[model samples]
Target: MDLSTLMLLCVFAFTAGLVDAIAGGGGLIQTPAALVLLPQYPVATIIATIKLPSFTGTGLAIGQYIRRVRLHFPTAVLMCITAFGAAFAGSALLTMVSSRFMKPVIFFILAGVAVYTYTKKNFGEHTTKPYSRKKQLWYAFLISLVIGFYDGFIGPGAGSFLILAFIALLGYDFLHASANAKLVNMATNSGSIALFLLKGTILWSVALPMAVCNGLGGIIGARLAIAKGNHFIRLFFLCIVTATLLRLAYDVFVKN
Candidate 1:
């Protein structure tokens, strides 16, 4: 990549990490920008290259969240394990099958999520009554499996979905949900990265510099989210979800 193009990608990566740290739709920014900027590369290569930066960004955000947020370690670990395995499977499947079929379904689901979150008011602001430990573990497993697969396969809004699941299924507030979602997201990214590395698809020239910018953005964004609290995250979440929904709508209805 030329210096100018590389610089542009870094900018997008930074912005993506910032938004993703707060609300989980970084791929909407980073992936599309990479695809647009590097049309010479295969789509798979671009996507795979993006994962390394994403992993680093999420890792940095997790570091920040760990200091301020209380995570449910047992369920979080279960989710991470399940997410890692599911993401690996999903990435393997992606090499064989087209992911185009998933876009419409996810579009509708995100629409519903956006609507529900907007109307519910106070949703994710405070924790609800806790589920039983068994139920929580089951919910976490199922959520990680489904969303992690989606992350590895479809590759957008997975972080948002993770936060949503943590809030709706596990009765976590926005902050705690985001913290745990970062953990699961990191695992999913690692799984996808492992697959991509095996396939030798990553563009390290771009991924390395972008990773630094993204990680720096993650640090700032995570600290901002920690300072601003749940209300800020809820607003950011809604915005990212809406943006993801619109992007999917275009891909499904317009691009095709």
Candidate 2:
């Protein structure tokens, strides 16, 4: 890429990192920035480049969260393994599934999720009873498996979906849900990174700088979210869901 374009990409990565750190939808920003800047490259290459920044950002955010809030280790571990395995399997079968056919349905689901959260009073504001360990494990495993597969096969809103699943199905409050979502998202990104590596789709030059920018953004965002607590997360989650829904609508209906 040209110097000007490269700089633009870095800026986008920085912004993407900040958004992702707060609300879990950085791809909604960084991926499009890659497409706009590196129009000549394969989509996969653009995506891989974003990964470098995303992983770095996630690592930073994880550290930030670890310092302030204790992560649920068992949930994190199970989700990661399931997500990793599922993403691998999904990547292997990527060619078989067509995202266009699925996009409308995904959009509708996201719409419902967004609406439900908006309308429900106290919807993700308070921690409810912890599900039985076995139940939580099962839900987390299934969610990771299905959502992880989606991340590898056709990626969009993977983080948002993971957060939504944890909140609605597993009954986590927004703060814990966001925290748990990162662990799962990190796995999803790792899975996508490995597959993109196998396919040789990553543009390392772009990815490296963007990764640093995105990492910085993640660190700042995660720290702020941790400091603010659940009320802030719930509000931010609604904002992200709205943005995600709009993105899906444009992609599925307007652009397509």
Candidate 3:
């Protein structure tokens, strides 16, 4: 990499580490940085590089969240299987279709999700669960399949959105939902990484330092958020998701 690109990558990697550690949308930081810094880079490589740091960031985030938030193993397992399979299929199919075609619709979807969460007064503040295992499982299945496929295909903010869906649909508090999102999101990233490895597009040099920094960031961020408690995390989540929505919306309608 050139000096400019190297500097850019370093900055992006650090930002990604911090953002991902806090609320799990680090890809939104690093992927676009790759696009802008390495304009000549293949789209495939851009995608693969994203997974390298993310895997590290999320691996740490997962451990941190699990330490703090109690998990429902059965639902997490179901989510993992479905998400991994769906993401693999989605990534394979992604090359065949143009993601740009869906940008407008996706913009609307992001706006709606952001608005929905903002409108809810106590959405992520506290746990208020009331359900049977069977009911939660159905939502978990849908979340894994839908979000996982989207993650593999488009590859941004997948973790945050998964958590939101888990909270809204399953009535999980933000903390538990975040823990669950980590499990399912791991599968999505793993699946996409597997496909990218097959494509031979990853650059280990760019990915290695990024992964280490991201891992440290994840550990620090997760611990801080847990210590700070629900209200701070919820607001922080809102800020990142809203920022992502704006960026994606602009990328879709204006930039295109």
Candidate 4:
């Protein structure tokens, strides 16, 4: 890549990491940037390239969140384990299934999340454990499995979906939900990156520089989110999910 192209990708990666650290839709930015900037590459190569920066950014964000927010280690560990396995399974299945079919399904689901969150007014504001410990573990595992598979299969809004599930189903506040989401996101990214590495699909030269910028942006964004607190996160989550919903709707309806 030329210096100009590399610079532009770095800028996008920085912005993507910031948005992703705050609200979980960073791929919504980076993927489109990759498509436009590196159109010559195969889709798998583009995704692999994208994952390198994302993994680095998410790792940094996880560190920041862990320092500021209290996490449930048992649930987070279980989710991470299931998420890694499910992500690998999903990536393997991608060779057989058509990811196009998932677009509409995801659009509708994101739409529901937007609506439910909007109408509830105070959803995800306070941490309230509505379920028993066993039930919470069961729910977290299920969410990680499904969303992790989706992350590997289709690759957009998975973090947002995970955060939403944690808030809505698992009765976590947005801050804690986001913290947990980061851990699982890192695991899922690692799973996908492992497969891409095995296949030799990643564009390492482009991804490494982008990863540095992404990590820088992630650190700043995670600190901001931590300082600002849950209300800020809730608002940002709504905006990112809405943007993701619109983007997916365009892809499924207009672009298709």
lDDT of each: 0.92, 0.81, 0.81, 0.90
| Model 2: lDDT to the true structure | 0.81
- How much lDDT does candidate 4 score? 0.90
Clash totals in order: 0, 2, 0, 0
Better of 2 and 4 by TM-score: 4
lDDT of candidate 4 over 1-256, digit per residue (tens): 6999989999999999998998799999988998899988988899888898999999999899988798889988999999998888888788568799889988998899999988888888776776789999999999999999999889778989998988878888888888899899998998888888888999999999999999998898899899998889988999999999999999999998
Best by lDDT: 1
> How should the candidates be ordered by lDDT, best one leading?
1, 4, 2, 3
* Prediction 1 TM-score vs. true: 0.98
| lDDT comparison, 1 vs 3, better candidate | 1
- Model 1 shows how many backbone clashes? 0
Cα distance off (Å), candidate 3, residue 12? 1.6
Per-model TM-score versus the true fold: 0.98, 0.95, 0.93, 0.97
lDDT digits (tens) for residues 1-256 of candidate 1? 6899999999999998888898899999999999999999999999899999999999999999999998878888888899999999899999999999999999999999999999999899666656787877888899999999989888778999999988888788899888888999999999999999999999999999999999998999999999999999999999999999999999999999
What does candidate 3's lDDT look like per residue over 1-256, in tens digits?
7766776787787778767767778888888888888778788787787787887877888899888788888888999999999998889888678677766777777788778778887988656668787988998999999999999888667878887887778877777777787788789888888888898888888888777877777777788777887787788788888878888878886888
Minimal lDDT window, size 10, model 2 = 90-99
Residue 250 C-alpha lDDT in model 1 = 98
Model 1 clash pairs are none
